[model samples]
Target chain A: MANDLVVAPMLVVLASIVAMLALRPRPRAQRVASVAGSLAYAVAVGAVAWLIVLSPDAPGAATYQLGGWAAPFGITFVVDALSAFMLTIAAVVGLAAVVFSVVFVDRANQGVFYHLLFHCLLLGVTGAFLTGDLFNLFVWFEVMLMASYVLVAFYGGPQHTAAGFRYLVLNVVGSVLLLLAVGGLYATTGTLNMADMSRRLADPAAYGIDPAPVVGLGALAFATFSLKAGLVPFQFWVPGAYRSAPLPVAATLAGVTKKVGMYAIVRVYFTVFAGATVGISVPGAAGASPLAFLAPALLVMGSASILVGGLGAIACDTLDEMLAYSSIGQVGFIAVPVAIAAAAPPGSLRRLGLVAALVYALHHALAKSLLFFATAAIRSATGTHRLSDLGGLASRAPVLAGCFFVGSLSLVGIPPLTGFFGKFLVFEAAARQFTASSGLAGGAVIAVVLVGAVLTILYTTRAWTRSFWGRRTPAVEGATVRRSQVAVLVGLAALIVCLGIGFDPVFEFATAAAEAALDREGYVELVGPAGGDGA
Target chain B: MKTTARIVVPIILVLAISLLLQGHNLPGGGFIAGVLTTVAFALIYVAQGLDYLDSGVLGQEVESGAGVFEHRSVTAFRQTFMVGLAVAVASGFAALLFDEPFLTQTFVIVEHLPLYHELEFASALAFDVGVYMVVVGVLLTILSVVGAE
Candidate 1:
């Protein structure tokens, strides 16, 4: 049953790849196959989520041994609440993207294996989420990156090529750093299995290893993940990459790919190195955990990202460019909760932070995909994504305008939308931390997040009003909007609204995922030996 | 180039087959074997040209065959690649039907064989063969598609 949880998605991926390869020369067949494949993948992911939810065990994590080999030696796939949740989100977004691409992508681009690469990208992401070992996570990351490299450069234009090249180079550098960190960790812990590594790291001194180097390696791993997630000081490539990518591909990358990075950070920080301590030594003081020292830095960076991204979005002229910048800010919002989650002890506060992060991630995936899909339709209808060249789209394509308006409102965290609940949760968590800690850092995080939220509204409103309102421009006069594309946007918008209205169940789901994520002992027990060896 | 191809292609093919066959027990495996086979074909293409591959040394009838190989190397490789992927996935699914985890391998031993006393057959070998075909097909597809341009 556990093996089926992992293999189901993989089988969909493999079957999709085969279908694409077989039907490559036939565009119509390829489109149908890709859509069907994506739908099947979504169903498989849904089943996996259902299985995880129905598990009798507390925390709900199931570990599947590949080829019947046990963990700490052979590959294993772990489907916990968090992983299942992420998988479901990814599959849903992937399905929407693929379906949109059937008519959204031009014929020439479709011929160049678009469907094949899309499925490969999903495979990589799902594999990353489910993998139980660090090395396999890296492998999955590479698979994801490889597909993205081509997708970013799908148009074969000069700007697209340059943007793709920068994306490639930066990601490759991040990969190398990750590999170095993984090597150092394996050397110190003598294991690549995450649970085994966690157990070993819990008492490094017993293994004759120094804790400082291990802590440093963990920081390196965090830095690499931050780079992948497009955090501040490492986000130079994102705007270009997002701006130049084919619109649907950009939607998938922003909606799904960057969250994989965030997932890795959560997995590594909370699970693999959950026990490391990292504060200054005081003769009579209790030792502080590494996450305590790391949290402030992450908070500062997260705050900086919000400021930079929000300001950049306000300053950008093009619609896609603004959305790209908005992505950075939204990611920063997600990061705020991540920092709090990492810093807080295993309690309600920490769980709140984790839940906030998960909710924010879910909101961002849907809202951003919706926004980008709307951009695709707008671009198709207007023949440009430039804001100045487009106006009065509401009159020409009222459905698209309405979808974009709803998406923008959700993105800005307006009331009664999914994004508002996400932002509200983060604020509540930050306030809780501030009250408990009464520290300057916690207060600052709360302040910065508040400001970031305000700025989000300002920028999203500006982009919305500038593009969709006022007198019609020449560019919008004779543009044709495809019904299928509009349907995708409306569907996502409807989901956003539905989830917003039914926030209690969704929030509870996210809380459960957070609980599973923070259950270090439960994870170790499931993936490692019980009351033996390292235990 | 022709002299080099004449001397190297046959040896490469033989080496690839040996590697593929022994992969189940030895360090040599389907991936390397497939790569080696692709290298041989690439060498032939570089030395003897696409025309040679289509209708020359391998013969027109061989190229025009209904199964597997085709006159157009790209199309043939594409088909081969898809088939290989399907086969690989199907092999994994085979275990699921038997109430086992995916990609599970089971061995069957035959006793009192004609030439040898016994032989062991493993489903993993079939999976490996699928992988081998995929590797060769992908590499050739890239080579032929890029080479044609």
Candidate 2:
């Protein structure tokens, strides 16, 4: 079954390369082939997700050993519930972005290997989700980043090039830090396999390793992921990159790629360092877990991200820039639950926190993608994305306006929407943890998250009122939205509603995945014993 | 310059082929061989130019030589790239047919050849061939595009 999981990414990579080569001169055929290829990739990923859901009683994850070699020595791919959930969302978003690009992307841009790079980007994103080891995760991140750099600079304007360069430089630094961390980890545990490393870290004395270096390395790893996730202080690149990129590319980056960073944070912190202790023992105090220290740090950063992103969005002039800042804010919301999950011991509270994070990520992926797609339509119709230049779109392009409205409401966490449930779960989880643990810090974190939620409404409402209902400008009155573009937006809007209204099954699935992620014993057992020194 | 390139190119081509053939037994492999082949073509382009390389050594006068080849060379590199990619993917998937994980290699020894000694072949050789084609095709495509620019 795990072997089947590899087929999804491999198919996309192969089909896209073939399509690019075979139909480069024929733009029409290339478009059709790219859409078909992506849809097929989505189906393959869906099948893998189905396989995971079918056998709930199955122990551990489904592991596939590449080249018939076993764990630690060879590359392994695993499809646990969490990976399957992430893969499913990535595929759905990838398919939607590709479909939207067919008409939204200008012909000039499409001709220059856009489809090829898009699929390659999908390949990287999905590979990151499925890989069972840290080294392969880095490889997938590189594959994803290289394709993104090209796509970001696809338009070849000065602003695009400059933004792409900043994105490149920042990520290269992140990559270096990641490599150094991975090196330190391998040197300490003598295994690159994530599960094996986790087991080794659990009992470092037997391996003749000091726990301090491992804990320090874990912090280094966290810093690297923070840069990738665009957490506060490292989020300056988001607005610039999002503002300059082509609409479809920006949508893909916001909707799918950024989540890969969040996924890494969850995977590394929860699975690798879950049982390992950090910090020093004092003469009179009980030994504090590293997570106790790390969790508060994450909460502080998450709060700062929310404040900066929300305030920045309110100050932005253009619709794209506002949404870019909004992404930073939403990422902070997702990080809040991660902090709670990490801080709490393994139990229902931790599970709740993890589930909240997953739910938030899913909602954000859908809503954010819809918003960016709406931006594409607005930019194409009005010849600009500046909010002040646009108005009265509700009467002219009702479907487009409606799409934006629905996406906005969802993003703001208005009642009976997907985002509302996502935020509710995180808030509920935080409150529950606070009461159960009797920690005053948890109460403060809850207050910060609530304030962040309110700020979300403020920024989103501001953008909504100005862009959709402020007044009818000349440019807005004359602009015409295409039917195909409207259809794409409508389709995404429909999914948001379905997720909101039919929240039970999705929530249940997220819970199961959270449990799978938390079950360290199951993961280690599935990966099996590492050979030789790795054991 | 043309005389020297003409004299050296064939020897380089032979060396590349030898590298490819001996790859399974030694350090020289598909990637190095493909790079060497590209270097040989690059020397031709540097000495005689794009038109000369595209038309082959015989020039446009030969009916089968210049016109047909020149038109195709522009698109041929692209085709080569895709074909190589497909081949590599196919070889990896071939293991799936036998209930094995992806990219698994299977070896066979053939002893019945009339003119040659017994040879050991692995499915990985096909994958290496695919890699060889991809490297050559991609390098050539890059060279052509850059040269045109």
Candidate 3:
């Protein structure tokens, strides 16, 4: 059972996917596998949740070594609170998307469609969570990208294909940059273990070494990560891909893909480059330390994303597209705390950012997935996805309308729900001010994020008004809330409430992870320093 | 493109680059190899049909698909990811021989053999193998998609 705890999730996804391989595909097997794979993955998520709940206070993280070799070498699978939290998020979101994919697949022969790409996607998610080294993380990320490329283009319409191309192309460019960063680090530092790299960065003081090289490396890595995370300037890829992808895929893309980027950012920057920003020079941003230079830059970018993403969502027609832009803004919210943390050694602003990020991530993940799934249900019933054509949906399909309202309200940051708390955390964090300069700037950015939340409410209410609040209209056959569909959405709604109501426990978990993340000692402490090598 | 040459371009590029990246202890290493592989995979579609030329030269059907091939037409590509993983694992194992950590390429006889150390070549080869598989897999994946269309 103990070993099964770790191995079961992978097996469930693999087995479900592989089983679909033999099932004659076309309409029957493909949908079955898509839904089944998702259900099984949900169960697998439960397995991990059990692990976290059962061992809440354990001192060390759970680990499994692939092929049984030790570190400084072998690929290690580490499952701490941090990894587990991210895993749960990915699994839940992924499962929801796969479930939606069952119905979204085009009518063409989809031979083993769910089997191959879905399995790869799940494996990549699993791999990303489990890997303890930098190279394996990059590899797993590509695995995710490869699967996503095929899946995004699965519909094969010209528009879908074009979106897929754009998504794939930008991500590829980012991957190249990421690859360069990782390889550069490995080449210079001589180690692939992330924990090892952090140790090297922190130990420069002990060796009395100049901090310039590592600082530069940290900057390059962070910039690549920012591109991945879509932190301003590099955020052009999000709207198209999110708007164009099939619904389930869009949900996961919004939730899982964005988080993957942020997760890498946190893993590398906080764990590896934590305070290297203490002394660097960049124009405009006053830095308490050189490393602090990135703070002003991140703040500017984060604030811009918050404003741009919020306003951008208002112009889009489809609910999913609107949410896509909102996602960009949410990313700004997530970055707020980290940027402040970078400017100051440690402060409440960073802590608040951590909470806001956690809640926002959890909030957006569940809410966006439900929204996307609800869109599919609505379209199938009404044969359209535009909000203009969506009035009177509540009267036609009351349950779905209710679900959609809940999702939208949460997204809008309605008080007492998860979104509000996430925003509250960000606001609190921003107000705390790390460095005097950072404090002033962060306070201003917090105000920007605050306004962005109001925009979020306005847009979401607009959607609710358009879709469910007007006169009753004829409903399409597949649009009514089917028991199966509602079951999943309801499950998500439950999770949404649970996270909001139970913020303290989850917040502690995220904060602890954030705190440990900021501790660079774990980076190299995990990998013992090599003698004059990959250090 | 025909299946035969679909397998060769990557094999060749990987071998050449494997030789080039062997100098990383001083400049470029695994990083360059990964880049070369990424490009090789992207370029694979144009060159895969060259397998026909290989078939003519060998007077064989040119079967390779990582699966058994009845038509012997390079079998839609046999890029051998297993070979790459094997090489990576093998290099990892060799590190054990020097009492070093896994993947930790111990530079034995570092002062002496300048032109080519077997392990350095071996390490670079391991990485190239990953490149080779990546190219073949991507090519095959695209081919499968195009063929289906």
In the range A1-535, model 1's lDDT, one tens digit per residue, is 6547766887788788888988987988998999999999999988777766644553366787777767788778898888988987898899999989887888888888888999999989988998989999999999999999999988889998999999999899899999999999888777888888777777776666556666678778888888878889787888999988888889988888899989998898887777765445533223366666557667777888899999999998899999899999889998989888777778889889989999999999999999999999988877898889888888899999999989988987887999999999999989999998898877888889989988998998888788888888899887898898999999999999999999987887788788878888888888874322542
Docking category for candidate 3? incorrect
Cα shift from native, residue A272, model 3 (Å): 1.1
Best by lDDT: 1
TM-scores, one per candidate: 0.94, 0.92, 0.77
Please provide, for model 2 over A1-535, each residue's C-alpha lDDT reduced to its tens digit, 9 standing for 90 to 100.
5556655565566667677767878999999999998888888877777765535654435887888988877888888889988887898888999999999998877988899899889889988998889998989999999999988888889999999999999999999999999999888778888988777777777777666676677778888788878899889999999888888888889878888988998887777767676567533223355566568667778878988998898899999999999999899998888888877767888899989999999999999999999999998898887878877778878889999999999998876779989999889888987897776776887888888888888888887778788678999988978889989999999999988999998898899789878887788888885685633
Alpha-carbon RMSD of each model: 3.3, 3.4, 7.4
Which candidate tops DockQ? 1
Ranked candidates (lDDT, high to low):
1, 2, 3
In order, the Cα lDDT scores of the candidates are: 0.85, 0.83, 0.66
Ranking by DockQ: 1, 2, 3
How do the candidates score on chain B by TM-score?
A: 0.84, 0.84, 0.46
Better of 1 and 2 by TM-score: 1
Top of the candidates by TM-score: 1
Candidate 2 lands at a TM-score of 0.92
The DockQ of each candidate is 0.66, 0.62, 0.07
